[model samples]
Target: MPLDQIPDEKEMSFLDHLEELRWHIIRSLIAIVVIAIAAFAMKDFVIGTVILGPSRTDFWTYQKLCQLADLIGTPALCIDSLTFELVSRKLSSQFMTHVSVSFVVGLVLGFPYLFWEIWRFIKPGLRPQERKASRGATFSVSVLFMMGVLFGYFMIAPISVRFFSTYQVDPSLQNLFDLSSYINTVTLIIFGCGILFQLPVIVYFLTKAGIVSSALMKAYRKHSIIVILILGAIVTPPDPFSQILIALPLMMLYQFSIVIAKRIEKREARQNKES
Candidate 1:
């Protein structure tokens, strides 16, 4: 789409776009702040229950692992216990932790609305066909992001917490974890996975824009596997089981992205032939 053909006038200066972006940022921030206030109000439930759920060995993940161990005849899968002491060293640590954690929780919950606001800002610049072509973008992005967030919180976060809490250099060294550190790790994993899981949606757009194709993705399958494994290793613990667990889902997402790209290509081709 050319500048003159866009809904916004071609005569509008770059400063005009900047001004529009400022409003978008303001709206996004307001939404986050409102949600943060709600999160803070639900202090006990959000902090004591949801945020710290994985800290206990009786979390659903541990129970599932135990059940899997029984079924597979692998005692190693049964997590009996995790040892770690959560502590606050500084006076302001707890207060800061509460505020920051609430903010992060707010952001996670408000992600869809945030993205919607972004879409609203960008949609004005898009041609009618372009907007139509990207229909359901917000819904698909939200669902994928939330799914990834849940996976990280329920699966990856618990596994990481269990592994790190149980790891020890020596019998004499006590495992004392800082509250801030723990929350940071959990938040990073949740948000990271959420962003990474947009692979399929990203591929759709990239293919539509003619930046990449399904054929390219198919040709690089082996290389993609190596990259996926490397990504898994970067995100997960050094253990092969953990790496493979992360890699498998990533590879599946890659394959799914290829399919999405191919569908987009075929659809575009059909539309062009009709035209």
Candidate 2:
């Protein structure tokens, strides 16, 4: 259909909007499946190198920690080994896990395109100024997501895995973990961080909608610190150092969100004055 022939959001009925949204969702799913198929083909590398990297003692994070330990003359940070094992109990557990992991990898890799499709569906409903204001939203969101994933994979996942794999409740028992559980822990932390890293983007939209202000965020700084510390404890190992490491970045992100909100407020004020 020509752009002129198609009805605007105001002219379209509720069912028409649903129909449009359905198509958008279908396209996004198709993109994910295509990418997932490719990921499945490279399962060996993805699963062996990427997914299971944190489980090994010689992993980059452990290596870095060892170096830091040497520099500081503290042997506590040096992790010589991971004292745990992964086993699959179900008949089809491995196969099913491979399939699920491929799909998740596809979703993470194709997030930018997925958001593009969603943005296309939403753009027509927005005013010209709104569209202009949201320019680069997809890129900004994608960058933040990737950064969070890397942080989780490189820093958070390894630390958590090390702590859990080594900490034994009893000396007589061995730490044996299910393969599915291990994968879930790794991916959950990765995707959770990826989503959490979008704090500034979330604040941007809220600020744009006049639902949030920088002053409010500033006033709530102390409360946010407490929340961040709790979140750090939840995501990280039960150690003060690990919790502080996680909380530091989150605190920075919160401060950055306040800056974003302030910029938006200033821009709106300037626009108002000009109008």
Please tell me which predicted candidate would have the highest lDDT against the true structure: 2
In model 1, the clashing pairs are none
Question: What lDDT is obtained when candidate 2 is compared to the true structure?
Answer: 0.87
lDDT of 2 by residue, 1-275 (tens): 32223756448778877888888788899999999999899987889888988988878999999999999999998988899999999999999999999999999998888998888888877888888999999999999999989998998898889878878778999998999999988898888788878889999999999998999999999999999888877766677766787788899999999999999999899989999
Model 2, C-alpha of 83: deviation from truth (Å)? 0.8
What digit string (tens of lDDT, one per residue) describes model 1 on residues 1-275?
Answer: 32323555455678876777777778888889899999988989998888888898788888999999999999998887888989999999999988998899879888999998788778777777889889999999999999889988888888888888877779899999999988888888788778878888988889888998999999999999998888767766666766676678788999999998888889989999999
Candidate 2's C-alpha runs over 4 A off are 1-10, 233-242
Q: What would the C-alpha RMSD of candidate 2 be, to one decimal place?
A: 2.3
Global lDDT scores for all candidate models: 0.85, 0.87
Per-candidate TM equals 0.91, 0.92
